[model samples]
Target: MKKIVLLLFFLAVIAQTAFAQVKKPTLMVIPADAWCMNNDYMTTYSAQGITMNVPDYKLALQNDIDLLNVITKIGELMAERGFPLKDLSSTIRSLEQSSAENEMLMSATSGASLAETPYEKLMSRAKADILIELVWKINTVGPKRSVTYTLRGLDAYTNKQIAAATGTGAPSISAETPVLLEEAVLSNMDNFASQLQMYFDDLQTNGREVSVEILTFDNGSGVNLESEFDGEMLTDIIDTWMYNHTVEHRYSVSDATENRMLLEQVRIPLFRENGMPMDTRNFVNNLRRDLRKAPYNIECKLLTKGLGKAVLVLGEK
Candidate 1:
């Protein structure tokens, strides 16, 4: 009997340790300022030559629904990713109520409004090691429409921004704006969570130190070509370079080339032409070379050492 009791205690201890090792708490805060637009133009439509205005209370109710959806989706994603969801539903409900009150108060005043409200207070009350703030915006330019969102993670106690992610979703002026918003939020949830996880992993492995470097370059073709590269050109370049060199070559079925040769022959020339000092003729030649070598394979490394991360942006020479 004594041996059996000891065995049972040991098993219980092991179980507790395993559980503790897997359990992590995270808090997600979506402020009202994160909403796509300060003005809900959808509520300002006119029908039959009579302008129809949405009541503040009604708008508040709708805002609560939107907030609830965002919070629920985030909580679900976190739970799926091995984070404890403890009391998330209740927390979401509380946030919804707070959001409703804030929207109501803001509806009354056009210019002057409360600096801080119950909603902000409640969000501030959420306690966790990591906190994520989600902000979204909707913009219309001519006939083009765009939706943008940003996810920022911060240390709860220190209030220091740890990690951030930004992504844009397809935009349309159709009646499905709300549905589009939900889809965009859900689509980016994994990325947002992954960034937070990376931050936490860094904190455990290294200290609190992170760095970012932005290297802007012309396409290296000196033809004065006019083409829209959008804002993802840098990421596209890095991804293509990494895929060809390091990732499996199943896509193109090619053996890995020497890193140094690839860097000098293709990558260095690009930087030298666009980033380094050079004469106009040399710049145009370099640009022409890069343009002619479109779809070239390049390789680069994103090295993170002891909280210092650097993206050694490389291109085909």
Candidate 2:
């Protein structure tokens, strides 16, 4: 009997390992675009010819404490479904501290500021596989309040909409927005999570989508991607880098040129060594490090266009 019990336990262990191999995508929950726009938590940041309208999560939280609770509650709901979550509030705090450090260590630019939003900075450090966005409204009628919510799960690596859910809560005596939001989500949270999981499974077999581009600076010192490096053009060297670094060697070259290269369909690992998720920036950063080595000693700036595309501006100081 004991031998049979041990066999059962071993089989259970193997089953668990196989399930874990499937992997759950890490998540980052934040206020939805509509909520931010309504609250005016927005800022424009431009760099390297790319511009983005990003949210000020910290500012939104400052304006309303319930916003934090709303995000936290949504995260809790997702967490119950076995997904790991990065706290946007905590990420904002860390960014604030980092910003202070930057101010102390460096001088400010005199021209127009190009400061990115807290959401953008948070996106960089969290490196979550998906970004869960929440938008909720509380309606009061006849002494009862109900919450209507729209939840969306976007691919953190690609900015694609992978899942969406909308629901209305039962009217309750409590007029609290957070409570209403939680109640509304609980009604269909399981289905929402299932849809996200299905999408993640697809991303696992196929690869997460992303785009990569290489461009030479106009003020360059005449050294472009066509320059010879180790008997091969610098463009060829970068192509080799992508082929070697992409997960499972899966990627598609959309276009290539002496001074520009466009690569799409990049396959990247879902997580890093420290358990943080990986994204386009992390993949390009690796290439940047390689290019800084002895033969190619290239100077460049890494800019992200949306969540999925990485731009490496070559020859920019």
Candidate 3:
């Protein structure tokens, strides 16, 4: 009897391990913005009368052989540890091919384009679960050389740094950036992987974090947060929908008024019912579609700024 109990326990443990291995988070490695600027791969982007300098990822990937080597090495290492990887250069190229003409989403009522940062555009295209930003330098001591490296794992949806590793490898005679980087990473990879796993575990338990905002168009439609349907204000109805849809009903209403509603720290599920990845836009679009039905019959426009924030403009598509 004791032998049978032990066998069952071992089988259960093996089953749990297999289950955990099935949904490893996908990761992509890119050079840090600081690294890009230092390497002279910076470009200007303008939005809403605000011009700012951002990393020129395409230029960097095309011109910097060392950057490509470093990214490939990190990707290989992470893949060995069972995490799926996305190639940054490939993603950029794919985006270029798909959007040959600059695609802009404009408001039908106002003729205004959606606001988006350069980084946001990249994130929306890449669609990786975690973004690994890497920055490295070579230290020369007399004739010997060493690598100083930093790796930051950011949650793609929230842009929050979940894990980080930084260190300098022991002085080596090798001058290859990839070789020195591999040495530095080998020393820290285990700890970094453990940290990443912990973050993923938390995500499985708590769901993804995202923000949502409800706005009304100035089209003179009698629809706003103050509008009532079946004796419940539009604000209350949306709040109840959020409560019912979010994972564990975890979300906070930061501000609410007749014109707008802001919801932050919203905990949405990681996947949809059919096992596809779920994002902020999809979640909000679900709400938008529901509101379009019988009792509400609301018309709304859905605009997503990046991976984590979505805006639904009510009272005009």
Candidate 4:
């Protein structure tokens, strides 16, 4: 009888170990080259009729460098998260030439061709369950400069689009125009990569079908506003609350009373059921009240007044 009981306990331990060994799906990230150009296909129809002639090679090379940086960063981030990076060097090497061409031509331009040369293309043929496409564009709008980035993930086998995200950022207009543009691109690159990783992680855990939003308000008075409670916030709240009723993620307080600050939006997945508590409302409320009382010490302040308002305004189906 004693031997039988010991055998049963050993079997149970082996079963638990097997269950814990279940591997998560691997995500494949395909970093594509950027297509930056002074003249897009639309340049063909301008009143000047594509008078600006710039070499497409420079733009393509710049984009390639930028994309490589993003890929390296993402690889580092994923390795830190314990996810395997599928070998992509062969696929990247196969992409000898990628170009973008304007398919449409305006008739009004007549013989004055406002057409842009087909930009190089960056294609990825990786065989993996998940894939990511990162595209960026640099633009100089008069005195202001900006960069637009697009991030998309698709199922490698099915070719179905899983997630898509877009972000744009600009630099302050100043005498150091070139420096500001570089800074803007670098900053936007980090933001784009971070968001892409978050979305990819969600898709890997949950089904590919999920939606998330992140909203930030920067009032000059240093007050930051978030709409719905997020995992990052909840994690901090939990760690702090579990130890002591305190807040952990605090934004700067603003002195401007005129509401000069505006709100920005970000999207995220709903849930993953990965150790996070299902009920977060009470936790949020308690955290908020604690912050109000001890605002100076807490790292974050939960804006109870604005949470409901944000839900009412930005609720999704």
Candidate 5:
């Protein structure tokens, strides 16, 4: 009878402990750009004297089995910590579908270019709050090997490196590549994941950071940034709009010129009122709408360089 009572008491404690731990900030893991190049998962493009090499996750998915094994093991570790893993392939397929739909309907109707780079599409569809990047190399020395690794945790909304860890694994048998990689990750991942979570918690209380820029065309027209609207210069108007729209009026003007205005450290709510994630693209669209109305009534083009930097072109694209 005492044994039965003790077992029930321990089970209740276990249940309470499990229920007390809640996870936040969904995560997606992918190989680092440099790591892919070293492993031959690369694609190159050249326009002038410059050559650009980008990671080919698709090719890596198909060809790099050993790297995939390490990635899978790392994901398993994330899962053990109660962090949900977003699948990259599934995100890609969803993005492809949404891109096609946007092109077919919205682009055709509005006559706007719906062409998005693969990276942007993935960013839109992944639904991940943080991106965990893994870069690693395995070196074989005679019968044993070691793995040197770097892991970076980036905020999905801000593209900031909130957490990073690097280390070299202890030597082990040459064939123990996966095991060595696991140990290397395990040694630092708990702290890395905690840092990622802590960043989101901080962002929740204090808003996410974003940068905005205003520029005009270099055409012969005299459209200067100093031009005034309703007695306020274009730069001042932009500042007022930012102050009115941003969270708690938290933003700073780094530089202003007759042709350009740079606004940095703009704080935005983690989620929009509609419960959607707030990103630079969406936030700038609202700014565009406002700028197209009222005294300013400026017709401008909004371009986002990834998830955090947004540029508003005053005169032309």
Candidate 6:
């Protein structure tokens, strides 16, 4: 009996250790845009003579006590299930610091400034694999209050919704908002987590989805997609490279022209050959390097937007 008990204890310990070794996707919780708009936490920006409203995450985090409490509770619950969260406030602060530093630096050769859009700053700084958007409403009926909550898991790379859960909690006369929010999510958390796992599993199998566009600088280099190299059109060479480099030749040439080419649904490997995490910039830069070699002998400039889109301009930097 003593020997059987000791063997069982060792097996249990091994099982727990294995479970802990399993990798979980990194996640971050943010108030959904609807929640931000409804709560009056929004800011506007002008781009190309058009004004757009976007969620003011920094303002929301600083001003809303209930929002902080709800995010904390949800993060704690996720951490218990092996998925810890990237805190939004901390990421925002870090982004601000980096932005300030970038503003003070310029290229030594051209004296050009760092050009980054606000969206790029946020997405690059967050660095989470998944963004969990949370929205909740306090419903009061005759002094009894309940919370109607929605949680959506979005792939940070593709901005696609992979999982969602929505429901209302049982009404309570005295329970606080955080307690109600916790109760609402607890019932659906398991299924929501399962969906997230399914999405991650699909990523492991199919690779990450992104978009790549090929363009040319109008700098009179006499280079375009039709420009021939080694008896093959430049477009064909680029297409062949994409077929060979992308995961399993999974990408589509949505549009191709003399001056521009757009490739969508481009599936790239999750990691590079050296086992480092791969992003849009790294993936496109590989192509840029390849094009610079041997018969191609092309100089290319790479630009990336957010985490999933890259534009490569050929013929000159």
lDDT of 3 by residue, 76-180 (tens): 999988899989989888877756444665666778766767677778988888999999999998989999999999999888999999999988885588998
What is the TM-score of candidate 3?
Answer: 0.95
For all the candidates, what are their Cα RMSDs to the real structure? Answer: 19.9, 4.2, 1.8, 19.3, 6.0, 3.4
Say which candidate scores most in lDDT: 3
lDDT of 6 by residue, 269-290 (tens): 8889998888888999999998
Backbone clash count for every predicted candidate, in the order shown: 9, 0, 0, 25, 0, 0
Candidate 1 per-residue lDDT, tens place, 1-317, comes to 99999999999999999856842545655533324245452235344456644322234435566555655655666778776543434554666676667555642224443343332344343434566665666667676566576767776534577777677777666624445555566676677677777766654433222222223223463211122244434334433543443213111212222121111111111113245422222322332344345453332223211112222324322
lDDT value, candidate 3, whole model: 0.90
User: Tens-digit lDDT track for model 2 on 64-167?
Assistant: 88898888888888888899888887877777778765555422333444444456567776778898888888788889989889999998767789999998
What ranking of all candidate models by TM-score puts the best one first?
Answer: 3, 6, 2, 5, 1, 4
The digit string of per-residue lDDT tens for model 4 on 88-206 reads 55444453332222223233324333232321121123334456655556567777666666666664433556666665666455624334324444544455445545655554344
| 5 or 6, greater by TM-score | 6
* Runs in model 4 lying further than 4 Å from the true structure: 1-24, 31-63, 77-82, 90-126, 142-144, 172-317
Q: What is the C-alpha lDDT of each candidate?
A: 0.45, 0.81, 0.90, 0.40, 0.79, 0.89
Better-scoring candidate (TM-score), 1 or 2: 2
Cα deviation at 220, candidate 5, in Å, is 8.3
TM-score of 4: 0.31
Error of 3 at 64 (Å): 1.3
**Where in model 5 is the C-alpha error above 4 Å?**
1-23, 46-50, 94-121, 124-127, 156-159, 170-176, 217-224, 315-317
Question: Which of 3 and 6 is the better model by TM-score?
Answer: 3
- Clash pairs of candidate 2? none
Q: How many backbone clashes does candidate 1 have?
A: 9
Which pairs of residues have clashing backbones in candidate 3?
Answer: none
TM-scores of all predicted structures: 0.37, 0.78, 0.95, 0.31, 0.78, 0.90
